[model samples]
Target: MKVLYKKILDLEIWHDYYLGQPNPPKPPPTGYDISDMLALVPTPECLRVLRNLRWLFRPQPRGASIFAHVEQASSGDFATLLPVNRPEQLTFWLIVRDRYFANFTNLPLTTNRHQIYYFSNLSLNQGHALFLTQPLPNYAANSEYHLGQLVHHDGKTLEALLYQASASKNPNANDWDILPNSQYVSELDRLPQQGLSRIYTIPKANPGDIWRLTLVNVHEQETFVLDVTTPITHTPGDAIACSLNFSGQIPGCYKLCLNNIQVDRFVLCDPIASKDAFALVEIVLNQSLVPSAFSLLQPQDGNTLIKPKTYVIRCKNRATRWRYRYEKPHGFSAASLPNFELIDAKTYATKRPLGLRLQPDSLLTDGKDQLLPAPAIALIKPETDTQAHVTTIFSDIHL
Candidate 1:
């Protein structure tokens, strides 16, 4: 099976908002065969992000070379016995597009029927088997308890919470000002509650091991050992996972210790600050529609040469354009720090610093050459308005 598509799907899940609130579900996921999937191989940088995801385990029987996806599982599947392996994990591909958005009645899972240990070679793989679209049709009505769709922990929400939690330890940690042209800024503006959730591709977690999730916050010290159920097989290639639940917790940064080893952490931002919306600025290097490293200047004036202070976006693609912008801001105005100019072409400038919370009088797209001209097959498809959908960094700088 093509692994890259899986990575893209995982990343999409990590970045998406949880059912706590649902955005308009896009049309049914566009399915693709091997060729189409391979063509979308993101640059090495994206591969790096995919690499960062924690791999769960899936155990298969000794002769079972083939395994399949399982749709809505039954309650008694819990007692089904399977072989065991260490440091193994598994993730069920449950893609549900239902009318409820995330209103799955069976979303609140208990330790007994967690998803990690839910799959097996004996599991049916009906293509639709693993898909969880639209709350197990009103027809199957898989009992009242397991009825609703599942909900994974929202990574961005965790970041905000963790950021808030960190403030208790470091006052500088609550830096919630999203730089101009950041994804969250635009998401919030376009979709009020979007981007508040993070799309986290966690590090590899040991399969079959009872990992622990520790949340240390101002509210109360909390801890829980994760329950994993990997199939019994010495040699198998699959892992399982489920939605993490951090409900009933206060909003703040918290120390997240897993397996008592502090595998990762979570942050909860103040709800009010998170609700503020701004135009979303999708940026990429103009050179080849590839990713490039750049810096977002700090709000406070300072001599950075003494102490290098920079927010970096390291390039990880060979796409020609070193930087690219999917959407423009309200406008470009460096009045806060007048040494800047609106960029219009491909730029190789190393140091064009932007101030924090910079707002433009009007969007920069009004300028004739504000955007790089995209050819028919250009990476960027100009919006219907013919405005460049992506703004490439061609030239212009300010200090």
Candidate 2:
């Protein structure tokens, strides 16, 4: 529901079908925003379908982002069910920013028992439908299948019985089972505690070839090489599976590297942490970083005078980046301190704002704010050399 409406037509379309009504009676001036899907009021049998959709598309998990999720999805060609919304059998698509030219140009989507639609790979883009709201194509021999998938084969309908790499045949006699011909059940299944946590497909992967996968924690600065020795099996297309199992590990921002080159980055969080947004921090620097120190040009330790609302700290280094922090009245924890960056390298002076809390019994001239000089620290990283460094300089300035 947190959709961004960029044009007038977007607002109009939302107004017309916001109450779960069908599409607009007729085409509006904007033609048709095929990208914006208007949900329908669920029938009595499919009421839970709407609820599941809301849960799947809810705001990103804490410490994660939509872009990060998309990057993982687009890393390679894949088809997977939305993890939490499996009972509904809704298929999710994760397309790349640039159009992906799939090996199979035309793909079939089974929307219902009687409906099947064919779409071109060109129709896929970052803005495509998040969930197909339908099942994927019929079962193919030796193809990968996720849990709770509905598939129609030959004359009877079948569903996937196992998790990843499940039984490759129909469940009537193999992995999939036929559902009773009745109203759709709304019963929810408990969340899976164990299974393959994540899956990635490697396009153009040579059959029987192995690739090295490393999970690098952005915060802890730790790298763990996963045992990915299992040979990938090539099917229909050149795409192969690179399933990632991060079970029993701390959840944080992780970078997926293949053969030493960073391929994708994503955030992993527990169910509780997924409720709130976590600041997405990227430790990987795209450019060269070299730490360099600079001498304080102004406001030396003993140099104290009068300044109204702010004070300036001058430095001689022309750093590519600069950040600073000041001590608080109570005390200062370096880890908890927030950084304030100076954007321009030419500006040698960093202006520190003074925040004053006045008390009824305290006179303006006698207040602590006017009596003490704050301890400050400055950090800089220059691009002089290939080696990385963090140069820190400390000083005291009167306000």
TM-score of each predicted structure versus truth: 0.21, 0.22
Please provide, for model 2 over 1-399, each residue's C-alpha lDDT reduced to its tens digit, 9 standing for 90 to 100: 333211100001112111111222222234333132211111222224424322222211111111101111232321121222111211111211112111101111111221112111111111112111122355676676543344556644444433334344434354555532111101111112222267766665664566787776533243567644444545534666766777654433456787777776555434343222211111111111201111101121232111111011000111111222234243333322233223232211122211111111222221123333222223222121232221222222333
lDDT by residue (1-399, candidate 1, tens digit) is 532111101112211211111133221133311121111113223233223432122212110011212111143221101111111112122222233221112122122211111111111111212211111121112222111112112111111111121122221222221111111111101212211233322344444544445555322345333444443541234444444555443333345565555544433332343322111111111112211222111111211111111111100011111223334342433332132343443222212211111122222222233533221111221112233222221212221
Model 2 backbone overlap count:
3
Error of 1 at 20 (Å): 42
Worst 10 residues of 2 by lDDT: 310-319
lDDT for predicted candidate 2 compared with the true structure: 0.29
Sliding window of 10 residues with minimal summed lDDT for model 1:
311-320
Top candidate when judged by TM-score against the true structure: 2
User: In candidate 2, how many Å is residue 41 off?
Assistant: 39
TM-score of 1: 0.21
